[model samples]
Target: MLNVSNVSRVFGKKAAVDRISFTVDKPGFVGIIGRSGAGKSTFLRMMNRLTDATSGQIFVDGTDILALKGAAKRAWQGQCAMIFQQFNLVPRMDVASNVMHGVLNRRSTLATMFNLWSEADITRALSILDRLGIAEQAPKRAEALSGGQQQRVAIARALMQDPKIILADEPIASLDPMNAQIVMDALHRIHTEDGRMVIANLHTLDTARRYCDRVIGMRDGRIVFDGTPDLLTTSAARDIYGADASFSEAATSTSIDTLPRDQNYATTLLGA
Candidate 1:
């Protein structure tokens, strides 16, 4: 279980994520929805310590996640995988190679530097791709696949890590509705088939209604609503997103400055 107690992430004087508390004890599909700049991504990033929080307590099971250090911190990240809006694959690399990168943390220091993918790791990567229905593209360049296919490749990479929790930050935001549905299907299948908790930041209410077992609404960095999909009334959505807001309109920021642009960041983001 992931327990968040009075969590807030402040950037200077602005609280990107205000004081919020929630507990996710069940392993299932959860959708987080809100308008643009509602702090959804910030809260998700804070879960993996990708971004720091000004003050808060975060625990997985009984361990204080915020207190971890060194290898322990890396272990915490491995337990929680994250997917991004953009399919962050190495465009120039083969799909199989990109997927194999998921197990970088599991490799030895020398092995990682040499990019030594063991035979078992290669087989596992292929198996994951086959499960996701993309085995045929294994030898192709990641950039050659369609958007939907690329996202599935990303999911396969995440699966390779064997994470306990999967956090998808606006994963389908950049895809068309048809492609988005495919990505969402892959996400749903991952949760149901593996029993890993999936927390996805979603923009569309209809998608949330169709897939999420639970809906958590964020507004101004606070959790305004948390309930089953059926219980998320139209009025509640209005309160969460404000009146006259469309599904595509979300308060998001383009801030990669805080995230390190390195191999470490790439691997950490995958398993967190």
Candidate 2:
């Protein structure tokens, strides 16, 4: 459902992504894992044209995303929703209103100018909040909710778009252990039951193993490993993360099994 071919992003002399290529089949959960500055986030941003590639191509449902602009670009972006690590909700707005913002592409300037959302649109937004287990918070101000509730509101907003693909950039990064698991489970359920393509940038190797169908590893702006999570053994992690002599052996020894099943897992395993 998504194909990225030889994509590269250069900032002056530095290449954040260098000729990276990968594909995510329909309804697949693909995880991009790497240490900070390994270009995982850059790669995910390029997939939705949030950050354009300096070279090569990205295709969604067989259409070249780089070739689109203006209305075409906006339309394409609406089909692929993004969830940020911070949740990105408007503090003063209620949850229902925040979710309804996802359909701005479908609303006219006049309708939006008056802050008018149709009954059906509001109903759909409420339904999505319910699906994400945040329906009770719909009438509450976004800032009034907990971190986990805010993330669920973000997910509900994404679902309101009815997107074909979801790009989650460290979606669970800021939550507590239980909240992180809740968000991860919600994302997994979306990929499995809703049959939507999910591409997540994850810091925890264990979360990638448990939730992703395939894991892609990057180092120095290049893809070093692209396969099932089981293929990401001790040696593969060393190849992705090891640099200094002292850290090399220790990095490999700290595999997914040794990591905790909490939000601290990312910090402990990836040292992020």
> Candidate 1 lDDT, tens digit per residue, 54-81?
8988988988787788899888788888
lDDT of 2 by residue, 159-248 (tens): 988999999999988877667777787788888889998999987777788889899989989999999989877777877776653464
Quick one: best lDDT, which candidate? 2
Residue 195's lDDT within candidate 2 is: 92
Backbone atom clashes (below 3 Å) for every candidate? 9, 0
The C-alpha TM-scores of every prediction are 0.88, 0.89
> What's the residue-level lDDT of 240 in candidate 1?
89
Model 1 alpha-carbon drift over 4 Å, by segment: 244-272
Residue pairs with backbone overlap in model 2: none
- Tell me the deviation in Å of residue 158 in model 1: 0.6
C-alpha lDDT score of every prediction, in listed order:
0.82, 0.83
